[model samples]
Target: MQEFREILVAITNAHTSKAELAQAITLAADNQAELTFVSIVQPAWFENPLLSRDDFQSFWDEHLLAIAQPAMDAGITVTTRQICGHPFHEVIRLVETEGYDLVVKLAEPSGVFNRRQLTGNDLNLLRRCPCPVWMMQDKDAEQPAQAPVILVALDTSTDTPEQIALNRKLLASADHLALQEKASLHVLHVWDLYGEDRLQGPFINMSREQVNELLKETESTNRDRINTLVTTNGIGDAAQCHLVRGRASHEIQKLAASLKTDLIIMGTAGRTGLAAFVVGNTAENVFAGVDCSILAIKPDGKKHQAVSNETDANK
Candidate 1:
C-alpha cells in the first residue's frame, strides 16, 4: 500500500470544521507524515477598514496554531502558511512545488439550494492537482452509529495498461484508508451492455433471445474482471464486491448511499485539449449526487506539468 509522505490541508474559510481538521491530523499521525496547514488570503481581507493588516495577520496566526497544535502534540511534523493569491491556483502551486502527495480539504457547498456540493475550487483541484485530492463533507449530526464504510468505485471494462494501473491504485488507496480507519471496504463496478440500443434498432436483425444472451455475456465478462482485480489486490474475501448494471454515476451514488459510505475512493482521469477543463463526466455527476467524502486519484504519468505551464504562460 502507498503511504502519504507529505499531506497538505487547505483551510478554505473560517467555518472549516474541526472534525475535518482532526481527521487530517489523525491521518498524518497514522502515516507518520508531515502536515501543512495552508490558507489563501484574499486582497479583500487587507482592504477592509474594520480590520487592520496586523490584526488580520495575528488572527490567522492564532487560528492556524490552534489547528496545527494537535498534530504537533501527536509527534507529527507540522507547518502552516498563508499565501496571498487565488485559492485554487495557490493550493495547486504548493502541491506541485512542495511535492505533497495528498491534498485534503473540506468541500464547500454552493448554489442556491445549498446542497452538499463541491465548489468550483474543489472541482479544479480534483481535475488538475498532481496528486490525490481528498474532499471531505461535513459529518451529519444524525448519522448512524456504526463502523465506517468505504466504497471504492472501479472501472473494470477496460484492459488498457493505464486503466489497469489506475484500478490498482484506487484499490490500494481504499484498502490503506480502510485499515487506518478500521472501516469496512466495499468495491463497486457499474457495468452495462454498450451499444445495446443500436443492437435492438430496426435496422439490425437481432432477436430478443440473442440480445439477452449478449447482455449475459457482457455481465459475465465484467464480473470476471472485477473478481480478478479484487483477488489481485488481496481483498477478495475481505471486501464486499458489487457488480451493478446501470449508468455508472447513478449506480455509484445508489450503492454509496445504501452502504452509508463514509468515503469514496475513485479515479479522475485528466484529459488533454478542451476536455481538460472538466473532470470525467461520471466523476462530476457522482460528486454532485453523493454526500459522502471523495478521495480522487489520477492515473500515473498524468502530472500537473501542463497546468503549470499554462499558468506560467498566462502570468
Candidate 2:
C-alpha cells in the first residue's frame, strides 16, 4: 500500500522458484525500494562438519549474485545476506535489525515439489514478522497486471473494536494497493451460521419457513455490518462488496479464483488454545487452496506468541 522504502525477501536453498524474485522485483520497481534477499543455511549434524565458514560464505555470495542479476537488469539495486540459523529466526532478525517494510517469499506448491519447501517457515514469518508478508504461489507469473484485480478477504461478523480496526487496516491497505496498481478492488465476506448443523437435528421442531426466515435475518444483519464497514472506511463505490454463504476457507479460495485475483489481501487474527495448535484459521486455509499471491496482515495489537512456542519446541 504505502511506498515500501525497504523490503526483505526470504529464500531457502531448496525453494528456488523464480516467481518469488519476479514478484519482489516488481514491488521494488513500483516503490523504488531497496531490496535485500536473505537465506538461511542450517547445517545438519549428519553432514560434513569440517567445511569452513569461508566456503559457505563464498557459496552464498555467488548464489545470491546470480539471483540478483534479474533485479539488477530491472534497474533496481539488490543486495543479499547469508545467515546460519533457523530460517524464520534469521528473517525476523533481519526485518527487526534493518527496518524492512515488507517480507516476500514463495509458498510451497503441493505434491513432489513440496518436499523441498518450508511450509513452517512461511507460517512463522507471517505470524511473527511485524511487517506484511507476501507469499507468491506461482514464481513464473509475470509482473502483476497494470490494472490488477485485488480482493480483500474479511470477517465481518464480529463488531468488536479490535475486529473493526483490523477491517479498517485491511480496507486502507487494499485501497492503497488498488490506487497504486490502478487495480479494481473487491471486498469478500464469507459467512457460515453458528450451529448450522444443529438446525437439521431431529430435536429441532422448527418449520422450513422458520428456518428460512432465521437464515434471512442473519444474512441481513451481516450485510448491514459489512455495509457499515465499507462505509466507515469510505471505500465508496471503488470496491464492490460480495457477501456469500459457506465455510470461509473454502469460499474465499473459490471467490479469489473466480475473480481471477492478482493479489488476495487478508488478515490473520491469531488464534489460541487447542484449535490454534491443531489447525490454521480461515486465512491459512484459504492460503493453502489459492494459487494467487497473498498479502497477509496481522492485527494492530496482537503478537502471535503461539508461533514462538512452536519454533522453540522445534529447536
Candidate 3:
C-alpha cells in the first residue's frame, strides 16, 4: 500500500458537504494518519471586493472547525487553517508545501453552471495536483448510509513499466478502499481490436469467424492478466470482473450507472499534453457527467504542464 501519512481535506463552505468531512475523518482515524483541513477564503475586504474580511473569516472558521472537532474527537491529529485564493490554487499550494500524499474534497454539487455536475476547479486539481485527489460524491446524501460499490478501471493494454506500476497502484488503492468500506469491488478492462473492422473484405480477406477468434484471443489474454494480478496481489475472486469491448470512458460510465456504483477508482493515464474537461481523455470524459464519486490517482510526482498553463490562463 502507498504511504498516506499526511492527508489534506478541503472543506468548501459554498454548501454543506458533511459527507466529505465524515469520509476524511474516518480515513484519518482508521489509518492513524494526520489530517489537515483547509477552507479557502477571500483575501481580505479591501483586496477581493467580493467578500468582506469579517464575513469570510467567520464562514471559514465555522466551516473548518466543524470538520476539525470531529477528527480531534476521534483521536486523530487534526489541523485546520484558512487560506486565500481560488479553491484549486490553495489546495495545490498546501499539497506542495506540506507534502500531502492524498487530497480529499467534495465533488462540486450540481447547479445551472454545473451541468456536468463538477466544478472547473475539480477538473484542474485532478489534472495538476501532484497527489491523488478524492472527489467525494454528493449522491450519498440522497441515499441511506450503506456500503458503497467501488469500481476499479484497469488499462492492461499499456505495456510500459511505468504504466504497469501505476495500474498496480490503482488496483491496490481500489482493494484497500473497498475493504475499508466493506464495499463490493468491480474490476473492469476495456479493449477494442483496432483495425479489425477494416480488415474484413472479399475473397482473400478475414471472415466473421476469424474476427470472432481474434476477439476471443484478445479477451482471453486480458482475462489472464487480470487473474494473475488479483491472485498475486491477494485480491479475492468474490470481486466482479468485466472485460468489455468499448471505449473506455463510455463503457465505464455505463457500467457504473447500471450498477449504481458509489465510487470509481481510476488512474489518470493523461500526460502533460492532454486537454482538461474534455471527452478525449478518460478522466476528463468521466468527470464530465458521471454521478458517482471518482478517485483520480496520478503517478507519483508527475506534473501536467498543459493543465498548469490552462489554469494560469484562466487566472
Candidate 4:
C-alpha cells in the first residue's frame, strides 16, 4: 500500500502461462506501479560454447521477445531488456541501476524431495536484492484478485521498532483483505534455545527448572513484543501469534506449510561483508531454505538513525 512507483518483474526465455502474465501486469496496474520485464538469455557458448551463433542466438532473442509481447499489450507500462551474462549479476545490476521497489519472479518447480527450489541465480538475488522479492507460485503467480492473508514471521533477535512498524502496516493491509476474502492474519514467533545461537550443549547441562525458566523468559519477551506491536499499532484482535521452539528457519517453514499461508512476510537486516558472507543471517539462511513463498522485507534505511545520532553526539 506504500507508494511504490517502480517495480520490476524478471522473466526468462521459457514459456509463461497467460494467467501468470496477466497477474503480474494487473498487480502493477492496480498498485499504479511501473513494470519492467527482464529476461536473461544464457549465451550459447556455455552449454555448447562451440555451437554456431546464428542458429541458437537468434532463436533465443525471438523467443524472449515473443514472450514479452503479451505483458506489453496489457496496458501495464513494460520495459523489456535482454542481458547476456550471469543471470544473478545482471539481475542485481538491473535492480541497483533501475531502483525497483520490488522484484517479482516465478517460483521454481517442485522436485521430488524439495517442494520448490530457487535457482542459484534466484538464490543470490533473494539474499541481496536491493528491495523485497516476491516469489509467486504458478497458481498464485499473478496478483491476488482479492485480499491476501499476510503471514508475518517474527522472532526475538531481529525485533526492532522499524520492523514492528512494517509488520503493523502489513497487518493493516491484511485487515482490508479480510473484508473481501475474509482473510485471517497469523503472526508466528519461533524461539528455539538451541537455534543458531548454538547454545544446545550448554543448555543441556542446566537443571530442568533452569531450562524451563529460560524458556519461560523467552516466551514472555516474545509475547511482550507482540503485545507492544499489536497495542501500539492497534492491529485487529483477529491477528494472533504462535510461539514455538526449534530451528528458526525450519520452524517457520513448518508453520507456513501447516497454516497454508498465502504469503510469508519476514524481515532481513541485509548484512554483507565477512560477518554475513562467512556466517549468514537468519533471514538469508531461511530464504534459500524455505518451501513456501517468501516476501523478505529489508529494514528501512531509517533504522540507522540511532547509529548516526550516537556518532554525532560523540563528535
What lDDT score belongs to each candidate, Candidate 1 first?
Answer: 0.82, 0.77, 0.76, 0.62
State residue 284's C-alpha deviation in candidate 2, in Å. 1.7
In model 4, the runs with Cα more than 4 Å from the true position are 13-22, 45-62, 107-115, 137-148, 157-182, 194-207, 274-291, 302-315
Candidate 1 lDDT tens digits, 198-289: 88788997888999999898889889998999999888687999999999999999999988888899998765556756545677679788
Report the C-alpha lDDT of model 2 over 1-315, residue by residue, as the tens digit. Answer: 367879888886546677777778878998899998887656652155776667766667788889888998988978877776777777777876788988988765446745323266666666667778887874576665556799998888888899888888899999887887789999989887787667767898667777888889889988998888889888889999999998888888898888888889999765444444445666667777777878988888665553334553234
Per-residue lDDT over 1-315 for candidate 4, one digit per residue giving the tens place of the 0 to 100 score: 455567777764353556556656656766776787777655534367566667666776687677667767766676777676655566667777778888777754545576454554555556667777776654544445655556777755347677666666555544433443466778777775554333335754656666678878777887787777666656647787777777787887777767666767776665544332333555545655654456776655622111211111101
TM-score of each: 0.92, 0.85, 0.86, 0.73
- Measured on C-alpha atoms, candidate 4 has an lDDT of 0.62
Looking at candidate 2, the ten consecutive residues that score lowest on lDDT are 306-315
Model 3 has an lDDT value of: 0.76
Better of 1 and 3 by lDDT: 1
| Model 1 pairs in collision | none
Clashes of 2: 1
Pairwise TM-score winner, candidates 1 and 3 = 1
